[model samples]
Target: MQQQAPKAYIIVSNDKNEIQKTSAYTAKTLSSIIKTCLGPRAMQKMVLTKINSIEMSNDGNSILREMDVNHPSARCLIELSRTQDEECGDGTTSVLIFASELLNQIVPHLKTLHPIKVCNILRKAKDICINHLNTIAMEAAESDLINIVTSSVATKLCCVLKLPIPELALRSVQLIKSSIDGRIDVKNDIKIEKILGNFDECEIIEGIILEKEIIHSQMRRSIENPKILILDMPLEYRKGESVTNMEFSNKNDFTRALEIEEEQIHKMCGYIVDTGADIVITEKGISDLALSILYEKQITAIRRIKKSDSNRISKATGATVLNRLEDASPKHLGEAGMFEYVKIGKEYFCKLSKCKNPKAISVILRGPTRDVLTEIERNFMDAVKVARNVLLNPKLVPGGGASEMSMALKLNNSNDKEEKIIFRECGVALKVIPSILSTNSGNGICLDVINELEKKQNKDGPYFGINGITGEISDMKNIVLEPLVVKTQCIKSGFEAVMQILRVDGIIESKSK
Candidate 1:
């Protein structure tokens, strides 16, 4: 009995064929879920989360994130959307669609060939497609940014916005770009606020907007050419870091302590007032004594502002945030041409605008409801990100599946039958984008649209693509354009995700007692 040892159990959960089928099935299922959410005619999904939160969106990434999937292949597809979003900020849906179609094309080959062979062929095809894409890319001019951004926003719900969203996005990017004299940071420089109203009221401001009101009612509600002072430290008296007991000799001692606190607050307020600042904004709290002093000096004060908001205020107004009252200086004060306290709906917002060289701005979005506003914000953000990509890369590609069709056609042109056979599947996968676009374009005949695009693409080159709106083959040079980097990243991300699932040969699980 002592010599007989227990045998270990090695459970083979799935073989190679079974694993590939499972992964392919998972990819197809997820892709089917997001395929209808591809183009302008795409339908939205109403997802109910575990916590009973309902999200209605056509965004592939958002929908996938709300889904609770335990399968490894499904997770890979979801992660592919996330990677596409993070890398290019657009094409989240397109990437997943491409991956699913690619997996479908190769699953047949996987039955006869090794997974490594398929992966090698896919890797080679992906590189070739990207190089071809680079050759087909056009240099993006300033005027082209509108088309690029418009193309990105057209597929979202915000396309119904009455305002010129593309121009607003470009203007915001340009405003920040001109002020910084360097590369643009869209997330940090541009702020989006969603308010309940009609879309006509949407506006883009040249400076940041504070969703806060004046701390003191007696303070000025508006100021002209105001000098702003930003503070990181509290204007109230300092308190001990830890609790300590103080034994007062009499009631007079307690009164004297209060007097000292008031004196400290007065000293702090005196420093701010001496700087001739028309507005005081602090990341930390301000005491009543300091508020009264600031109001008495005809200064507007907003306290308990978020640190990020304070930084934005400082950037917009050209002010340096100070932590100490003694360090206040006129040179450190920020200047703005106008400051107004306005009431919108039930909340009051402070707007600072007309800066000499503002580095930050806000886009106020007015929608019919919160959910609609949220979708609009998401769409607008994607537009902003597309604009940023164009600005940073300064390269464009024809949108509406033109690039994909062109690459697919080029990939298919081979003399050797073997090369054609191997790469043709890759080409077919690339064609999935245009196919899905055509299917979602409200066209009854998807195959006919794809056939027309293929013929036109072969003759007219890569600029020929299916018009997502009308499902007609048209030139996408002026109508729709995408950031070249986004298209490249989509192909690369999709290939990587497909290979990740395809290379998995088997699953092993140990039995738990």
Candidate 2:
């Protein structure tokens, strides 16, 4: 017998059931892969890259970016998650989960109303949800922010950052906070570097780490109150761009030529030292002779530093990277309280410490395996980003799905004021969060537990959500909480994604030209 033809793509075409099934399958398809990476009990996904490399990560954003998702709806959800990760850092999974659930609920209602009408109603309901988020969110202290980050990191399916992650994250915020109105610039200020070692060994250094070694062994490995100079030129003989040939009539001429070159090298070193720069960072090579000369002068010189690193030093130390040494002066040098070469594993890193004020800092991550460290770094970033977002907004909301359930309770119970067409389904769909949390944690979602959360919706309970691990209703704020922005953005982005996909009436395929 021959293989039967495919089942005629029941939901792939345009219809009410089509929208519902396709959206549900797409959402479920995407969520099923990473939902296990949800709470503290989440699991890691070992994804195979196109190059045949295996990546074990629990980061939702990472998985979303790397996964081979083909459906338009799925890609929309993935992009929504990316925005969440970019703007907020954490909660990518939450946004996608909420979108999938919300779309899944809207699928059945497609038969009752036109997509345009449904979308219009959703926009209004979204405003209501956002207001609810802002109303319920409370201002949090620094300690509460740390707790939120720790809670987020601990639930990472890849590598739960134990203690070092939270400790280092808080320190990073503090260090990054030292600049400009004491605000943390997550993208620009905080930098992350990964190393091979135990994850627990990871720590946040107070300053930036440049992956460079001294140009000469004779140079001191440590310097205090180091004045730093950034150079973009080579100290070697300036062989003009075009080659030059010369004939010496006698050996004296050759000797004089060699002496002149040595004199130039010495003169360059003198000018550098004259600037009172204890550390000279060059973008180009430093000749052996120049290195020896600098070593004798007790100046710590690092050569062949990448352009990016040089710029970071400039930003961190207020040093100007001069193209010509003749332009150098005391004013051009940057000040660092301390500078030292730190040995981690087999590599030596230049550590810049003790700046009066630094606009940039670095976060160093260590792990036993490269694969594990890769994921750990991603999770570390997720935590760091969330921490930074909290600082910008500093408003906290109960996590563990309490916020969504509360939103649903209010919307579902709304009486007489607004139409129930679109808002009603969203209210019903909001429970997807806690329900999934309960199911993912291996606990059967008890209706009574959900009902209890809804029943207490009217009361002043900031801690109302299911304990995903135990399937019990408890104070979720103590175990897990999130930034108000994270909650608000999730709802806004999730519903908007659903509307975009739902409004697609059909896929028009043109004949290949």
Give the winner by TM-score: 1
TM-scores of all models? 0.91, 0.87
Model 1 misplacement above 4 A: 1-14, 49-54, 161-163, 178-181, 248-252, 413-420, 508-513
Q: What tens digits encode model 2's per-residue C-alpha lDDT throughout 363-394?
A: 77877877777777677677777777787788
- List model 1 lDDT by residue over 1-513, tens digit each: 346545555434445577778788888899999999987678889988677977788888888988999877888789889877766678999998898988888887766778887787778888989999899899987767786787787767767555567777878887888534667877788888888987888888878888997878879998999999999998888899999788899979999988998988888888988999999998999888888888889989998988888878887899999998798999999999899999876678999988877788888988888877877777777778787888888888888889998888878767765557768998888888888889888875988888888888777688988788888888998578888899999998888888888888765544433
Q: CA shift at 13, candidate 1, in angstroms?
A: 4.4
List the pairs of residues colliding in candidate 2: 197-367, 337-354
Where model 2 places Cα greater than 4 Å from the true spot, the runs are: 1-21, 157-161, 239-266, 413-418, 459-463, 508-513
Query: lDDT (0-100) at residue 28 of candidate 1?
Result: 89
> Clash pairs of candidate 1?
none
225 in model 1: Cα distance from truth in Å? 0.8
Q: Model 1: what TM-score? A: 0.91
lDDT of each: 0.83, 0.78
Q: Positional deviation of 173 in candidate 1, in angstroms?
A: 1.8
